[model samples]
Target: MDNLALIESFGDFKDEKGISKIDLMAIIEDSLKTLLRKRYDSDDHFDVIVNPDKGDFQIFLNKMIVEDEMSEDDDLEIELSEAKKIDESFEVGEEYTQEILVSQLGRRSVLTLKQILSTKLQEYNNAALYDEFHDKIGEIVVGEVHHIRNKHVILLDDEGNEFILPKENQIPSDYFKKGESIRSIVESVDFHGSKPQIILSRTSPVFLEKLLELEIPEIQDGTIILKKVVRIPGEKAKIAVDAYDDRIDPVGACVGVKGSRIHGVVRELKNENIDVIQWSKNPEIMVKRALGNVTVNKIEINEETKYALVYTPVEEISRVIGKQGQNIRLATWLSGYEIDVYREKREDDDVNIDEFRDEIEDWVIDEFKKVGLLTARSIVDKDTDVLAKLVDLEDETIDDVKQILKAELDI
Candidate 1:
């Protein structure tokens, strides 16, 4: 290829691909030098000059000027007669400088130079991508769904960098179609070979934290510090927050006015319920808050075992345990304590469901326990229709169970 044509094509590529001019020029120079070394056995006497802006380059070969009869090494020495023809000032024992045309590199060598340049450019791009993502671990990123695989989903960023969202890293309820935009945190970056393997995760606790940061100005600006975050993916999450300024109600700031601030975060998480709790250094107080909307009567902590026993009103027990035990699980994770729930016995009226397991079948008692009704009082407090709706039981069966319990209590 012609010098200007070659330079222009590479310059256009550099601009279109967002490569630095200095880096592109260096690659070009190195490729040309490689071609020279291959053809002449060494590039020690070749100098490559490139003007990226003007898309022009020059290659000069320097040789020692020697007597016409004494020019034994054609690659390292030029005859004075030949040097004087180009410049009469040329003298023996002096260097003769001559411009070498790109066309002189021959068709095969020129093709090899282009191949080398392309390979080097690809390598540089991969290195740059790896560095960029390595610094973004735990930070959020957005990409478009490109391909869905059996184990993961492939996404393309705005710059078309591919990222992997493993099935395990996606929220349980998360569903994305091709061409849909997805937001996730950069879980990790690795390299199998020269390609960057960027992993994204929507199920990470950091993803929830980042979403909170994006939605709540107080958290982002440090007015309210996010102390901790724990999540059950698309089901529920709890975050502990505190602020240096006592006047700033950290929970209020994070939750916003009537959930105006947290609504965005919830939507992004596929309607995951998020509970914002005021942070406390005392584990007892923190565990109480982590239990969310429940009104705890007392908390007993065993610090050595990192365990806690929580007592709440029987009616509030279901709210504490939540659906599928997600609430309590997240609360335990947030507070760093394994918690067991108990009902506060204000009167002798309440009785454990196990007491009636002989009258009620074991499977029947299990159904009630699954809905968080562990006490006879909790079951009786619910209307028969409500209890029937909560469990897979007929209304008449619920009424019969309540009547038997009531007869034992003499209510």
Candidate 2:
């Protein structure tokens, strides 16, 4: 291409990529200077003046005039005989200035200039993308699914910026088709070489936090503060929220009437069950609230070990633990404590070991039965070490047996 065509081509690229004109000019000048150095060995004696708006540039080379045979480097010192051809009065020991046309750079140098400019512009774009997304971490975004792969899904924003939703970062129940609109949080931004990898996550706790902020004006306006969020992705999630004002019920406000406000967030997360609870400074109340809003009869906390033993009514035990123990697991994470649930014993109720024959091993039940610990409560009430000594079983086995008994009897 001619000089003007080349510059105009750069201008077209700049406009298409949404690059600033000043940045494009800087890249162009640097590219040209790089080519000058490659062709002339050094660009120190070259003056490059560029006018990107006018789509043109000027290059002038300066060399000291020397005797024809005495010229050591043609790039820095031109022979006097050659200088005299351009101007007869030209003499040795003086500097000679000559204009270098872009066309004179030849086809190979022009192609090299294009390559350098394209590389620089691409690097600039990647850096800009990284910076923009880095600052936006933990913020939610919606993008169209452009491609789905085994390990990750590629999403494109309105402006066509690519984001990656890795399989591990997606909710367990999440499934997306090409061209589907997906909403997620910008979890992280990193560089794999010069390419910026913008990672989006649908399973992050921050994703739920951001969704709550978007859906609830109380949260967005700072009237309610989201204290913490913990999740099992598509299975269950728990968020602790607090409000400074006594009149405002943070949990009820977030849940809305008949679960109106949080419905959208739940649907977006593939119907992940969310439990919103009021945060409290008292660890016992916090632990009780974290346990899926269950009515705990008692809570014994060991602050140094960050562990708690919660006793709830027998009927509330299943709800406290949830399906597959997800609720209690989330409560443990949210409360910063290792929680063990116990059923509040009643004098009238006791499940015989034979009643748990379906859940406990025959050999395990026989071992407990032999010790006269026929009732499920009898096994649960004893410590692991004491039970192990009485039942001729390992502490782990005794513990497992206790768990099975407790689970079956709703403890």
Winning model by TM-score: 2
The TM-score that candidate 2 achieves is 0.81
Tens-place lDDT digits, model 1, residues 320-354: 87766788899999999999988654556467777
lDDT tens per residue, model 2, 14-65? 8888997777778788888988888887799999888867757788888999
Q: Relative to the true structure, how large is the alpha-carbon lDDT of every model?
A: 0.87, 0.87
**Scored by Cα lDDT, where does model 2 land?**
0.87
How well does candidate 1 score on lDDT at residue 141? 91
What is the lDDT for 184 in model 1?
94
lDDT of 1: 0.87
**RMSD per prediction, one decimal?**
7.7, 5.9
In model 1, which regions exceed 4 Å deviation? 40-45, 51-55, 62-98, 295-323, 338-411
**Candidate 1: Cα lDDT at 188:** 94
